[model samples]
Target chain A: MKKTSVFGPTTALAAMVANPLAAQDAVGIDDKVNQVFADLTGPFVSLIFAPFPGTSFPWIVMWLVIAATVFTLYFGFVQFRFFKHAVQLVKGDYSDPNDAGEVSHFQALATALSGTVGLGNIAGVAVAVGIGGPGATFWMILAGLLGMASKFTECTLGVKYRNEYEDGTVSGGPMYYISKGFNELGLPGGKILAVVFSIFCILGALGGGNMFQANQAHAQISGIVGDYPGWITGIIFAAVVFAVIVGGIKSIANVTEKVVPFMGILYVGAALVILIVNYDQIGWAFGQIFAGAFTGLGVAGGMVGALIQGFKRAAFSNEAGVGSAAIAHSAVRTKEPITEGFVSLLEPLIDTVVICTMTALVIVISQQMIINPETGSYMLNEAGTAIATVDGNSGVALTSAAFASGISWFPYVLAIAVVLFAFSTMISWSYYGLKAWTYLFGESKTSELVFKVIFCVFIVIGAAASLGPVIDFSDAAIFAMAVVNIFCLYFLMKLVKTELSSYAARLDSGEIKKFTH
Target chain B: MTVKLVVGLDGTETGDRALAFAKDLASKIDASELIAIYVIEWSPFTFQTADENAKRHLRREEEIELATSRIVEPAVSALRKAGFNARGIVRHGDVAETLDKLTVENEGSQIIVGRASADGFTKRMFGSSTQNLVMHASVPVTVVG
Candidate 1:
């Protein structure tokens, strides 16, 4: 007889306990039923999400953005001051082959450019513009300009700390510079940072340098040569790559030395044709680019947002501060390390300033043609956002469509260009990965063979398989490498300043002859 | 007493130099036999047709015969002219693996290869087959730079 009173406190407590237990059981059943419903719809949920991650601006892009900015500020805008000198160096006006290294300055530039000027410029930029809007393009150019300084610093350091073998071969890049640079600065964690950088370099080279390039090449080849399987494209690519890469650095240098200039000129010529044909839209395009850069018109966000998108895309495209290019530039045949540094700065100009800008113009101008007047979005819809349906495909395909819009059958030419770009990129990256591998394992015949075989095998795998997570992780690893590299570059920048002054002094005097290579 | 020498060459300027080196070496030794071997890697064909297989086989044979006539034969002929008994033979497999097999088959044969400059993919990948043979072969190998 618990008193069941009209208003007893004990009765109320009992009711509360009893009601909650009943509710808890009911809620449990509801949860179970909902889980079953979710299980039935799990695949649908995942399918909708498959493209979302690809669309989002990765945090690694942010890391690159910050690094580019810091380097730009720290270097007092060295990109502008040395812009002329960079061009001069690439022209072999100050090149010296008799210097203690393996490859010429132009060859070094080509090798480094081949690594940076691949699918990342095409597909990566397309993805950035696709999600972040036209505003992203403006920031990309700004970031590219800043990236020059970063490139100058890292490459200068690469050349400075490079290890010259008894046979006159050179080994340099972040793995050597970060550790050795820090050691010179009397830093405590030089060895540890160097080891970590080497590990990241190895991983990055395998993923970003090796597989990503192979994957893109496979895509382009399969796209153009209909009825061909991805694996077939991959196998062919791998074989060609194996043929070239087996020749090692000198072979790579020789091929890139020729391939890079030709491809670069051809690509730029095509873009120039597009821009020239669309000369009428040039005014509006520039207006839109500048406006969208600062004001973010039609975009959901404002100027700051556009800046982020642009910077992220540009950083991803050129990889100016990413330190990967430093590895390629390190093997240049020059006693003056800063000469290669100046040449290295030209990478961002070609990749970001010229190539990426052309892509942005094509995309932006084409959007004007296809956007639906009623929807404030483009005619075609993607992920609930209205965008133009160029070539009935997206990303790199959109770029190809934009090219085809201006020049009929241009896609075929573009496809060939893309394939070559991808192939050369893959070859150069294989060397980068090999260098990192050799650094980790001893430079034995078995070790070299094992790395090449594994690298070639992954080419096929990247071409055939779904590697969303792997690529994402690898892209992150490359940006992390930039973080470590830029950190070292900041401290050892004095070395670069010293080298630049000495080189300039010699140039002023008549001591250093021009075009010696 | 007959001595055997196995020589490997890729169809390059360096490979030609290696053949010449092998011939000169064989001429120095009495009763030395020379075998010139080239390894053909597998390629993807649209369809494995009879014509394709025949073409591949004929090509390999022609390469072997040509090497004997143009490279190995000249070397052997020179060796014979120099008053040493010499013969030329060709075999196909992986450069390193074939060199190993040839060494064992030609029992007590010396292996010779050219010093490959790091200038091409093939040379880079395999190094000098002579260097590989020296490292792993049961017999002595001399790499000519």
Candidate 2:
């Protein structure tokens, strides 16, 4: 075990763990767990993250970027062209009172945004800027803009091919679209592709959605309260999640829905305050972003490195093409399938373009990152991690340090935000996973319970142990979903184009009435 | 002159008293009518999960159906049987806004609504729907105690 810091908030439990005897046992268990998962998931992780031959770029990132670009062109820059209409749709300006029973465009957008706008904005951007330098922010914004097109295509397809049950509930996602959309096009492998996507979705929910979130939440809490066994936090979290998901305690869920958004606002508000305070540095920060994009600020691989990190994190952050947002959007009540698509494109804008940019700016402006005056690049430690002025901080800690620089009490606020973000993410992903589970096993109460139990168990494991391979596998599973989703989107692009054209014609003809001015 | 009194019903004893008062007032006036309106209070502002959002429309529909059947229909039929021209309206929105909007739509000259005991903290702090309607309704509002 690493030596406890002199000024660390070490409780009795922490002190006991710091004792050599207890420390050895804890390390032994962690090592054993890591060894098992790493060995098991090693090949799959390598295959997923494997770089292109003679380059550091992961092919999956290229896959998403290429697909997003194609959709942008094919849809005639739909994200930009329909931007105003999208806002109108969200504002209930075009929503007929007769169509009031289904999910509002605003609610669907909010639900989808909640799922995407969590740790990726907070920690993921920090990681991107820390390693890839300020240049990553520029590429992140560009990638986010392109991602809106991807969101447009998938969500349009999702609503076009959703399953409406007798009881009024509906389900849709890449799995539904891939299967039904391909079948409609007289393709044979739609079912198989959908099954593959579902399997990946379930795993992604467990690893990235559950485990990674639990791990990060624990990290943030421990940073504030004191170091202790992570299982203590995990068990407490699992109990609460269980009460919400299994026990059907809607009060907890309701409070969370209200609270999470407030937390999001608080986070953005804090970022804005910090940015406004450093009014002079705003220009210099943008200069760093622009300069670093091309020149790399002396970082390795420079521009290319920055581009790769930006694209990867933006894709992960907004999840524009991952098809998860499609499931949420599919439930909206609209006569035209294309309206939800318009509404969904704003998700990437809000998540990556607005929120993620705030985080990147705060990190860039705060100057927590140590730069070598001579080399004009970030100073690196022995492990090659970007050494912050705080010393040894990275990820959320680096972000915390950056925010704490401006507001001394920001870390406490950040800790609350992180925990809330993690909790909300887990709740959202549990629903996503349950949907996938029911699709595969046929929607039975027992099957859903099984998945929820397994998910909560994984949360405990995630918090208790540091399993790198497991997290890697979780990330791979999510991108693996993108791999399947984007490929299917290529075949189904024509359907979306036709729908958009028809909707546009009717809209121009005033067949679709605006309910509000 | 035809006087249309829009009465807000909540399927409570207080609502019955409001309807009875509206009926008595209409009886005393020539060519008067009673429009029983039940507002299923709802706001689009509340955040929901994907699953809950998916089912929101159905829930709203169910609420409308229930209110029409249980509250508005029964009261309107009774008013009709008592020899008053009556109709029922049910909508999902804020109570004061929906009631006032329904009144204006029907060209109502007066709004009659039951004033339930406003005991809750939020009600005390922000004022009840009856208070809101009396303060802001376009037509005259009668708060039946």
Candidate 3:
């Protein structure tokens, strides 16, 4: 068995059997950094991921999924109720051109979409379907549907408790409201939860947000060109990211805001084309998904496996329960906080329900995953659920292979898309990490600069390192963010409900002004 | 009767020319108040993270202070040195709309703006604020070259 630093001998052996690259990537931060990250984060990952004695499901995923189910019912399915109003809000039907926040409802939605509409839609979906099989797609869609209420609940509270300064800019998310809302309600633990949330936010920003993006981007780029060391990709990616973020040029940021959406449309449009071309097989693919979800066909762990994979990917994909999007959505320019909440419901609907579903459909319809025609089972390694690839490929490579089936040239486009998604996601997370950093350390210019530099350095670490354990730990850190933020969300949901009712009443009475021109 | 003349600050040669012209007009008019106003073009519709937006809010305040010291304060001081009642206020929004709002809000009698040199695609794209002010201002607008 090929031994890697972070992954134990058992995981390394299994991954090596599934993917040869796990054995081949020799140049990684497998020495000191890997050990340190693992030492610090390993126990937490184990605890958070500890499955029920008889099941393959992790408890943390259950935390988010169950909470989503609860919020979905408690909010009276606000995700469905406000569905049309959310569209109208995005169209600016009720915006008073004179409202006092930093961004329009549309811009806030677009910006927040950019943050979550990254590797999750492309690579994460592949990971889900790779392990869970086509049946997982059904569960994913269901989770995304329920997760919409989770997003609506948190983001509404985001706007209601946002801190609007004298200069017309607003700062918020779960951090502001978690503390403030709980304090108002005379509940204790707001301060502690907020502090823990920020700490996890910074770690998440560094790991899943930064490292994972860089690592995946390196994977895609190196596949096309000859394999180079990951640090080379890391440096170039970090330099460009540093310029857009620290350089503080309006034109550059403006171009990024414009470019990210354009890229998203292009990626989805390509998937749509493939789906259209394979229209006849679409019905058959749905049949397999539904059947596979229930019976799991010959898939390992059967129905339970599909359910777990679907819920996990969908939660991270739209980030509905994670509370990160609340930070971005909180800046919407409207006096009625519920308006932004309505706009935010569209985030998961697009990221998970729309885009992620598209990816799942393409993967399913492409017929790329080798199914033993005789056995009606996905061709996979016996040791693990991973679909075996030529070079032991997984993630984006598997997704790329599926796309390449119909359009031979699409992998090149996907490579470009992956890089763009990675870059934009990094930029978004840099800001998120910085806010949390400044929150913990004083918000001085020097403290912020120190955090920025440290963040840029981790990009290199992520790109260069093939430490599987480090990546796992990073994923755990990110989930930990949801743990803390969602706790606050449960408490502050009452505040959001209050705001929603008031905004609905005002709308019925025609109290809110609409900008016509 | 004292008249209030609002001059839009553009921070260009034309802006300087408009200010000089306004100074002369203020002197010629029997009793007049010349208000030098600089309006920053800001859109709350731009996509930015909460932290960036918060830092940007702080930056705008600093910019307003800097603009007052570097642009408006000198012009106002020059107007005072040239013998006139003058004050400056900096606001943020679409330049034309803000200047128009300032004139109405401050009860100015007339508006004077520099003819922006921007033309071609940029003019079509962004639309010259000077042109908008001339077209939409309720008060009489004097376009200074």
The best candidate in terms of DockQ: 2
Which rank order by DockQ, best down to worst? 2, 3, 1
Q: Output DockQ, candidate 1.
A: 0.02
Candidate that beats the other on lDDT, 1 or 2, i.e. the better one: 2
| lDDT: worst 10-residue window of model 1 chain A | A1-10
Summed backbone clashes in each candidate are 6, 2, 1
C-alpha lDDT of residue B97 in model 3 = 85
Query: Candidate 2: misplaced stretches above 4 Å?
Result: A1-16, A19-29, A372-390, B116-120
Measured with C-alpha atoms, the lDDT of residue A207 in candidate 1 is: 72
Q: What is residue B127's positional error in candidate 1, in angstroms? A: 36
Residue pairs with backbone overlap in model 2: A101-B57, A102-B57
Ranking by lDDT: 2, 3, 1
DockQ of each: 0.02, 0.67, 0.26
Candidate 3 regions with alpha-carbon error over 4 angstroms = A1-29, A164-169, A247-252, A372-393, B1-46, B56-145
Order of the predicted models by TM-score, top scorer first: 2, 3, 1
Taking the tens digit of each residue's C-alpha lDDT, what string does model 1 give over A238-318?
Answer: 777776666443454355545655766776777788888778988887886777677665554456656666776787778
lDDT of 3 by residue, A346-460 (tens): 8878988899889889888887777887987877765766654444545766778888887899889888887788888888888778767776786677998898888889898
